[model samples]
Target: MAFFGFKDFDRLSEVDLNIYRFFTANVDKVPYLRVRDIAREAHVSNSSVMRFIHKLGYDSFPEFKVSFRAEQQQAHPTNHQINFVTDQNFPTDIYEKIELVADRMQQADQVIFCAMGSSGALAEYAARQAAAVGFNAICVKDPFYPLVNQLKNTSDNLLIALSVSGKTIELLELLNNFINNEDVTLVAITAEPSSQVALMSRYVLGYSVPQQRIAKYYDLTTQVPALYLTEQLISTARRLAVQAGDHLI
Candidate 1:
């Protein structure tokens, strides 16, 4: 409820933040509501609403609403719009790939998540979910966080790699270290399934989210697609764990 008002969330003042809270709370109605309606609901002047839109770089309320609706399309696309792809060499469909990763987790003694930059958050989230479902979870956010021990873990491991571009040099190098290990099963969730990350993975779940960046370093692409896919995988794995009589924490 607190982080969805504008892309420049950090630059907002306390009053603007309050307006943002109102927007997040009533997201479905904001785009359709008139400026006066928003002002009344949010307990602010109409000028405040105008200022909020202007601060976000929109010329007018209509322009802002149009962009907001388009953003909504990307964030909450319909189920029929959900699509995942993988390399042609391994064509087992998306649902089957979920089952495949779940099967690997069933046998894996360790579940390590490897990612960096903006993607590091997804890695941590997926790792916590993995541990919640009972696998010993390890998160490697730093690219150089002692790879020798993580390359293979107790003869059985599953590494879930996340990236938007799938071309991160340090991350790819880390994955390459585990690519040849027979006991390690690598799974990649990326925008580009054909990239080297997917090529090295034992299974790949690809989504077609548009890549976005800021000034130079920040990747602004929506992680909604990847987030949904990872949650699905963890949920499926949790189901498998329950069916097998494992006590989940």
Candidate 2:
């Protein structure tokens, strides 16, 4: 919601940026936290909190918190927790979802795994796993010269994109080109189904894990959910391929 429809972040002072980072990092607790609570945790003054609130056009923290929580609730109506060991909210129909993705992979002329940074390594692993299962899979390591864009003859393609936040600018830009492509069946594995990339996907595997950051910009979210999802997808697709061949025989 563009930071809950607040756009004055760029106007914040250098010191204010600290408060901004803390606020974003702890957004799940924002509406419940008192202004003094925020001030203490963010290591800022009460007046600085007031200034930050005012800069975002809220007359007071209560007013801002209400709006923030409302926007968050409206965007995400369901819990996204995917911790297999502890997340009771883990998707109940996950196997069904994996089957659908497997169908897409089995039908594809080629499969592409798209991601960057930490997720990029996972993408490479997924690509190799898919290849081992006999699918023509490749990972796009560099967005500038992606093999997905260069392929000409393949009409049916399956794209598996992974991102913890699903807000990566480069990945979003790359997806912009495939939003309307009838030939591409996109499966977005990300932290939130409401994220920009997930919105563009034909199928989505969303998981809720804690987002951790280093230096306020580097993402350290756990990739276990993504890894598990890809492994399940490849396994299902391989089995489906064999069954379909048997039926043909």
The lDDT per prediction is: 0.82, 0.82
lDDT of 1 by residue, 1-249 (tens): 112444776777777877888988887888899999999988889999888778878888888888887787678875673334234323348778888888787777888888989899999998988887687887899988886674534678888999989999999988888878887889999889999999999889887766889897889988877887788888888888888888875
Kindly report which residue stretches of model 2 are placed more than 4 angstroms away from their true locations once superposed: 1-89, 246-249
Model 2 C-alpha RMSD vs. true structure (Å) is 15.9
Estimate TM-scores for all models.
0.63, 0.63
What is the lDDT, from 0 to 100, of the residue 48 in candidate 1?
Answer: 90
Q: Which ranges of candidate 1 are over 4 A from the true structure? A: 1-92, 150-153
Per-residue lDDT of candidate 2, residues 203-249 (tens digit): 99877677899997887877887888888889888889888892211
RMSD of each: 13.3, 15.9
Q: Lowest-lDDT window of 10 residues in candidate 2?
A: 81-90
Question: Looking at candidate 2, what is the lDDT of residue 190?
Answer: 89
